[model samples]
Target: KMSKEKIDLLKLMGANVILTRSDVSRGHPDYYLDMAERLSQQRGLFYTNQFANNANIEAHYRTTGPELWQQTEGRINAFVCGVGTGGTLTGVGRYLKEQSPDIEMVLADPEGSLLADKVNGLSAKLPGSWLVEGIGEDFVPDNCDLSIADHAFTVSDQDAFMYTQALFSRELILAGTSTGVLLTAALRYCQQQTEPKVVVTLACDTGYRYLSKAFNHQWLERHHLTGDLEGL
Candidate 1:
């Protein structure tokens, strides 16, 4: 469901985009892992294995984490996000924890991902499918440090999509699919809190990247996901 807008945006930014095809209709990090492995073995290509790259963590630690601290005026009680490379959670979580160990680093995982189960100290679920993109994994990435997360929330695809549409209706912000998953978890957590807390989650990417699928009403019906639109 890669939209032309996102591809064009990346090209405009001078990102050397290499297009590839996959048989998967659901999300796949293993596919990326396989590609990375192949590219690594090729002499001319240098592979920056994102899953294990410390730089990913450092980037978030130096920039994203500090910005959040400053933006919230040091009053942030929780940091919630989806785990893609695990870089954001690990890097940002580490930085925030160093500032205040009591700060909660929360994980928002799609239903089929093993991350939530891993975080909650429960047995992992059998591999399955979820429609959300950019985050969720069947295998743990080396870059992710689960020790930093204090809480984990698992969201289903239907709920995630509904929340995504709701976000547009309510905030006039068209965020990506994973953002919906993260926000759904964050909102659920916020509602369960006994006292008020300053919580934050990332708008992971642009909804413009998923126009053909998530934003299409017909796509939802075809996928049998329309029932939960107003239900969840």
Candidate 2:
């Protein structure tokens, strides 16, 4: 689900906003992606099927991957990220591997997502629900190249929210729920390493967009996140 602020901001930018069911699976008629496709067809509008779009992968591969390589001076040992449509994973992962095959491509997945298990070579499991939005998927999108993932980690909503809060309080960096999952996985990967290494993870979006969810104390309490904040 998207945050209220984001939805409002989109409307403020003059984009027509449409609400869809958050409870539906990918194949369901009410699923956001399916609904978007149906609406686009009915209205004779061009639909950007990001999940299967080569342009999505190519943009990240040509721009984001090269930028990271240049900014880091080619010393990066790992690239950590969450998979939404899979563009970033496949594109960046492919680019990084081409530059250096030793660079690790790490996957940070939400607790309820099947992506982590899929990376670990496990059989498909029924998808579960999570509080975090955008990153995790019930079904793996074609754009995502899971083969690039050398390691994977699953993060709970409690851990994601708590660490995201800490990122702001301690480091003064405002990040989103999905960023929390990436941060958690990156930290774990760093901690388990035997030697010093360069690691990279995404901030994704700002916390200002999630003020009513991850940044709300009352909402955190209601979701049982209050207790786990200290544990993290």
Candidate 3:
């Protein structure tokens, strides 16, 4: 997709180039890094911005906490989120802590992700595998601060997909798989709370991007993602 877009842009500028997508790059992280390097070398331009650091995490966390607080009329007492870039969790956790020292920050992780175990101070091991993308990681990112998370829940891909679909159907709000994981974690937290605490979680991205994958039963069946759809 990026290659196609780049080629179109160049064509608009009256430049001719041949570009091809390569599978030699492994994983999203490596692919992004390789693309950046290639673009810099080809265009004599380099990005000045920091790539993988904690600053973005902190900023996002701060924004999320305040927004939740305001949205819930300052009654929010807990938060649940999944970490991809880690900016959202770290930043929001910090902000929530500052606003109300007792607010609990919960990390929702996809099954087989290292984050939940890491946050709980468990021994690091090889991350398990899950179908859910974005929220699960083979390794903990630098921006994720486990210290801020009071608890963590590892959700299965099946659960994530079903919950997200149900959320859209029932609430009329389309959200991504990560959001479903977060919402499930939040509900668990809410159930455990003794009082009526306002718990919050992010909607993350829209669900449309996943329509061809999670939302389509045909796609799900083709990929064997259809087991126990009701559980999600």
Candidate 4:
């Protein structure tokens, strides 16, 4: 896990990194709570569960919400985003809803994720996997308030990766794969709108971290992404 090795390096710099079992899909949020409980019983574990933590949400409420409000001059008609920890959406959604309850908060979900189903009140399907990292879930995190989302869009892996590459070429922004999913959904939301509206989504991470996967042609081919995109 070269990506997580960065967290290990942080440990060397006195950042306490608690090693947990690999929970790939976020299918069961309980696994993390159980892990925390088990570890707490064994040792002096200070579990800062960011998933349900108010502080995590408040940080964005205070910082991101105000900044977006000011930057957009309060003309933000819509906010779309993918969920990793659910903090950003929860915080920003809370703030925006407070400002104007009429504002749209749309959830940009990966096709394989059950979250969109949850938000839309559809029956859950068998969970699947996607190439986009740091978003999509098999189970809703505690911080995910689906009421915030006026609508949801389920993006395919191909669509997500295609938009990711497009961002690199079109905007010169090497955005992460999850950001692509969000942006794709956001664009779709924009197109479907009846009136002129200001829609916003975020570039969640740098694409430099994904150079060996999403940015690699061989990896794309292996995953059948480029082929799928060509068909699209």
Candidate 5:
């Protein structure tokens, strides 16, 4: 983790600061950049290159897409992903489209996100509040190519959380919030197609990071999302 002392030193040395908050945690690169720009202007300084380029984020997404294609023997016809900083969705979507022009890139946005509206050629509105993290957006990112997405699904936070728990209990693959959205979208897409089509969705991150938030029953009950775990 980055330390506050180092951050303060960097700021003292004229480094443009980009402070990320929970409000933009599930938003896109454009949202973070715009926030940074506003802060910089208020402080009478220029803030450029305000984008997330974490190696961990890039590596995971890049690896997942290629692994899926290889495991499915290039038969994957559709992919569903949730957009966070547009890294995973943009990188994987671009790669899959380049390999197969007809492949459908589906975006799984939270119910109140602007992404679904933007992809469907509708005017985007300010997003409503949601419990899900690391997916959905109040604004779109510059790197995200809406044209590459053939369809979009607006999933609810409750469904996303419930299915995420199901994934852990059934498949033993503990995935985070964004993955829940993707899985829900992927199932929906698969059921709609009559033909035998291989579809892929990401397990964006491990559920360990969300234990305190999503996996805890106490937290769920606090949010009025309590349910039977036996079926999960």
Candidate 6:
């Protein structure tokens, strides 16, 4: 589900890219994460495993969380985020909670991901598929801390893409699909509020790389998203 522009950029940076099956889960040999780990061992390469890496969480705790607090002047009331490596959620959630325990930590999970239900205390179900890249997982990574979340929202691919297009048209913010998931859940959280609150979310990626997929009308049509996205 990654964009061609991103792949091209990686190639341009002199990285040997390996394309893996996107449909598989973590344990499958063909899964991207598993393949990367296996290949790294064989090649004797240092694999910075983001899922289990403490540095991933620490980076956000020291940098992103503090930056948000500083930029918002500590008036921020809630944080909305999608889970990928879970670094951002756990790290930022910990930092913000330390500053103010009342600050809500919300999860914006893709529809096919198990995280939303997991956070909301629902019974487990088999994980499905989603088109948005770089976020969501069939299983929670070691870096993820679901207890940090106060609420969770599941975002479908159709709604995410539609809102993402609307964001560009209405606000001129070219965000990636994952950002769409955040936007959808963030807006929902804002709407349900009985009092005014300063909500925070990240425009985690640039939409430029998604030109042929999330940003492409033809691609949407082919995927049967056009009909659903109409009038957005």
**TM-score of candidate 3 relative to the true fold:** 0.78
Query: In candidate 1, which residue ranges exceed 4 Å CA deviation?
Result: 1-30, 227-232
For the record, the alpha-carbon RMSD of candidate 2 to the native fold, in angstroms, is 1.3
Clashes of 1: 0
lDDT value for model 2? 0.92
Q: Considering only N, C-alpha and C atoms within 3 Å, which residue pairs clash in candidate 2?
A: none
For model 4 the TM-score comes to 0.85
Per-residue lDDT of 131 in model 3? 67
TM-score of each: 0.88, 0.96, 0.78, 0.85, 0.74, 0.96
Off by over 4 Å in 5: 1-66, 228-232
Q: Write the per-residue lDDT of candidate 2 for residues 109-200, one digit (tens) a residue.
A: 99999999999988888889899987999988989989999999999998898899988888899999999999999999999999999999
lDDT preference between candidates 1 and 3, better one: 1
Give, for candidate 4, the lowest lDDT window spanning 10 residues: 21-30
Stretches of candidate 3 above 4 Å error? Answer: 1-51, 227-232
lDDT of each: 0.85, 0.92, 0.74, 0.81, 0.75, 0.91
What digit string (tens of lDDT, one per residue) describes model 1 on residues 1-232? 3556677889999877766543442245446567667767877778888889899999999999999999999999999998989999999999999899989999999998889999899975675777787889877889999988999999998888888888887788999889989999999999889999999998888888887777889988897666544454
Model 4 lDDT tens row, 54-121: 88888989999888888999999999998777888889999998999989999999988888888888
Compared with the true structure, model 6 gives a TM-score of: 0.96
Q: How many clashes would you count in candidate 6?
A: 0
| 3 versus 5: better lDDT goes to | 5
RMSD of 3: 4.9
